[model samples]
Target chain A: MTRATKPMSLTVNDRQVGPVAVPEGLMMQDFLHEYLNLTGARMGCGQGICHACTVVVEEEDGTLAEMRTCIVGAHWFEGRRVRTIEGIAERDTDGAVTDLSPVQQAFIEHFSFQCGYCTPGFVIGATVLLDRLQREPVSREDLEEVITEALDKHICRCTGYIRYLEAVRDVALKTPGLVTS
Target chain B: MKKRFVVFYTAGVVLIFMFAAAVAVFFGAFQSSVVGSEVEEPLLPDERKALAERGAYVATAADCYACHTAPGGAPWAGGLPIETPFGIIYATNISPDKEHGIGEWTRAEFHRAMRDGVGKHGAPLYPAMPYVSYRKMTPEDVDAVYAYLMSREPMPVADKTNELTFPFNMRRLLRFWNLLNLPGDTFQARDDRSEQWNRGHYVVDALGHCGECHTPRNVMMGMKESAYLQGAVLEGMEAPDVTREGLLRMGFDAPSLAHFMQRGVSAQGGMTGDMFEVVHFSTQYMRQEDLDAMAAYLFDVDDIAAAEEPPPQPEPVEVSAEIAASARGTYLNLCSGCHGASGEGIPHVAVPMTTNITLRLEDPRNFLQTVLHGIPELDFPGVERMQPMPDFADKLDDQELADLATWMRARWGGQGSDVSPSDVENLRREAHD
Candidate 1:
């Protein structure tokens, strides 16, 4: 059977990536791995039940939400802005690693991940949570619940999830204006 | 003075007559419909085995275990709280424990309870027990079920107290309810109908008790006989009309309906909401022939006399440009990824929006609720499965959700775009409650 193809383009990591031909129903996970050669986002379960393959998508109104890459097709992200794990860290003029993002640093400091397969998804989730909190800060009392609501979906097999929770909580507390009185 | 005396006398007489009539009705409802002895002779090993096996089948068809067993609790040691309009009624333990469960209850008592909604101690049971539907079960079936219950492992769990409100808290009030709602006769085979049809009727009405949820109830909370299987909304979910005309209109034939019953998902759509429990616990375990019979009865195929044909699809209508433009992007970004760009639906992932009956519903409560709180990943019989639909409750605001629903309904559901932002808000609030 002849495969159907569609032309699409999207902004990835602040770069104009494609206006090229892609299979009609190719998943975003495959496109990230095979087409763009970006392997930071690890595919887990592939059914969207496990949110381990999520990437950040910026809405038209400049709000952020995580979309599962394994289940969503690449064409669905047409003309959209997205951020993967590889794009999270700071880069210098020579394109060398400058500094780790606060979420990444927190994860390392707290020993949040063991296998690191699920770390990318957790980082994305935490980043989105932090971004959301920036706009609408939570009270210290409701901080834990709010954090759980955001990062609860991302599964980590090796870590018991306590460290990850603590890491995210530490970032939320340390980052002023993210958690209010 | 003489005229006043005459009026007072007349009023007193009328009051007495009314009281007498009420007493007669109460006695009439309480009268035992089934006559049988609880005493039984000891059965041989072979006979006991056969009886137990038959009992198991009847119990499954009746779906006794689903209600009797609480989540993560011992089987038949009931603590499941059933929600009704009145209040929550916790299911009674039905294990073989003598003190707490129904171990000492006679077969005659079980028969009376099943047929009349009366407990072994002659107390009236709440209608949440579905005795109104179980009253239609044949004596043999009831006996088989009783045997099956006796065979279950007893867990010495005590019954939970019901938490009904005001006048409904009084069990004596149900005598009047029974007077209006209770049917006297057991299942009767229609001579004009085929055996399969009769069997199907028994399963649907008596054992399966589908009407408890599907059939609309009158003000008295009794199933309305005139509008049987017309569907009703309970706990914010609309059970769609399953009448012959309604089924056909929604694109269902016997084969597909039977297939859906046997294995939760079909080309039409997979079961969601309360129906998932029915499939997970009841219909999935039923025999294929019974499933076929149920489909045949629901579609009323015998009267058609024509060859079985697929139901015709609805003609596509154009959605308003404004709705299309507003919600199309949201749908593409969030939903279209799994549901398909054209709403064709990904096989084993999401159902095709075009034929999904939820959108075709007159009451958009179920549709709106599903969208606000997305469905969890579900497993159907065999290899059939669907991934969890991400909830848009936190992501999309009320207006966005309403627009998306309206767009979906108009574009593919053949429904009008009448879902206002307020409708989404109200349903979202109600879902939380």
Candidate 2:
């Protein structure tokens, strides 16, 4: 019942982090922002309704799913491999961002975000969708449905929803492996 | 001797007439010059264009588009419904459509509407128009607004009638309301204050109309000037006090308040609810100087001491095992997902239940209303994502709502009394009506 007793550990980005003692009810969002300083995982709606706090988690089977970090406790991520927004870019030897992820680039080219607070979640969600599609490609006609299903939960109060959707669609179309012609 | 006297009297009469004529000529020349300057000359084409542009800026300051434009409707076409305790009053079309909007309204007519809350035909307009505040606008500002509105592309949307109950259905009754509340005149720059302070006062009191929401209303639903900016509930959300004492509680100073107005984020948290929309539509678009001035004025307001001592604490409700179990069940089923099991809300995300002052208010009406209707998503600049709370009205009955509220108050609101089922029902009916 006490806070200090909970066992927590996870592989964040690529590195293994903590068999650290996370207090009971410590949100994964706080664990990332406060302890790790990975602010890319934003705390949007602690309620999981706005998926702005979404991070990509690799399942035991090596498949990815978007998880809401704000609602879940840090202890819940024990032994999990999670990818945050900070891990999305391709870094050079000096850790300088060499190239942006296709989704991130697409978001930029289309001017998909205004404040960028919601961008991290959108990137994670889109990344998961792209990963899923490469394994199981959908027809071009079903692309809209797939994008909606993936990114609909993330709320972007600015730039409307159209630009974000279009950006996602552009990536899906251009990334040859995602859609069947 | 008689002929000589007659000749002298005639000469004197002629001299008197000549003096009177000279005085009349002088007065006529002075009157014409004064009258010429008083009457505004017709604007040149370039001047008209410039004035129209300025009018657009003034319109933004006045926040005309926010209330007039419905969600996804044409800008200023005016179908937005304003919810009130008495009824829903829809905003009228101010677009320049001759048939459906204000295109046919003369300049004087428009000025009268803004200054007197009277329509083109002398019909009394509802105070929902905020004419009470608009009346403080200068004639030049009013004319500029008219010019801007006239220049806009007219949307031919017909105005929707207001839905009100019995006595409120009478628009004529607003004349009486106006008589009681309206301070009929334009803004006068205070001689004692600095220019910046006076400008700030004008922006807050006239254009921004901050008191319309922040000031508590009386029994007649008129704003309580004495308690200005001390806080009040608006449309089921608490508009926090912006007065000195209230700002002090929030730990805000002039610079921070200025920053909040400009960016919609402050040290406290992101602006949410109606204030979010206000920042997005109005203050964020304002000049930095104006925002700083408003902040300066706000900071200068003398702190009103707490009027009365805090109300005596109610006896704590002792929870039996069965009652606790029931309340816990309700809370877990409905609230635990967002509020968290321990009510430790994720910072900068969902507001923590533990620190939520709404649950501990003297009147529980807002809490009940929020539960029934849910909080809507507000768009704040820089703060990207917002989630709307889903209404439990359709899902939960009165008793269930009471149980949930009571549980929340007991667990989070330390000294709060239990909310009864009847209390829930009364609030629900008030909300519905």
Give per-residue CA lDDT, model 1, range A32-133, as digits (tens): 999999888888887676788889998888888898898777877889999998889999877788999999999999988888989999999999999999
Give per-residue CA lDDT, model 1, range B1-433, as digits (tens): 9999999999999999899877765555446455455423434446545677788988888888788899898899999999887889999899878998998887778887888888888878888899988888877777777777788888889989998899999787788888778876667889888777777788889988989888999999999989899999888888889988777766777777878887889777889877887888889999988887787777775432332776666665576777666677567656766777677888877888878877776677887888778888888888988877877787678888788888877766677646889998888888778
Superposed by TM-score, candidate 2 places the C-alpha of residue B422 at a distance from the truth, in angstroms, of 8.6
TM-score per candidate for chain A alone: 0.96, 0.94
Which of the numbered candidates is closest to the native, going by highest TM-score? 1
Worst 10 residues of 1 chain B by lDDT: B35-44
Best by lDDT: 1
Cα lDDT tens digits, model 2, B266-358, are 434456667878888999999987887787777763221212222232334555566566666555445555766766655555566664555
Local error of candidate 2 at B362, Å?
Answer: 7.1
What TM-score do all the candidates reach, one by one?
A: 0.85, 0.58
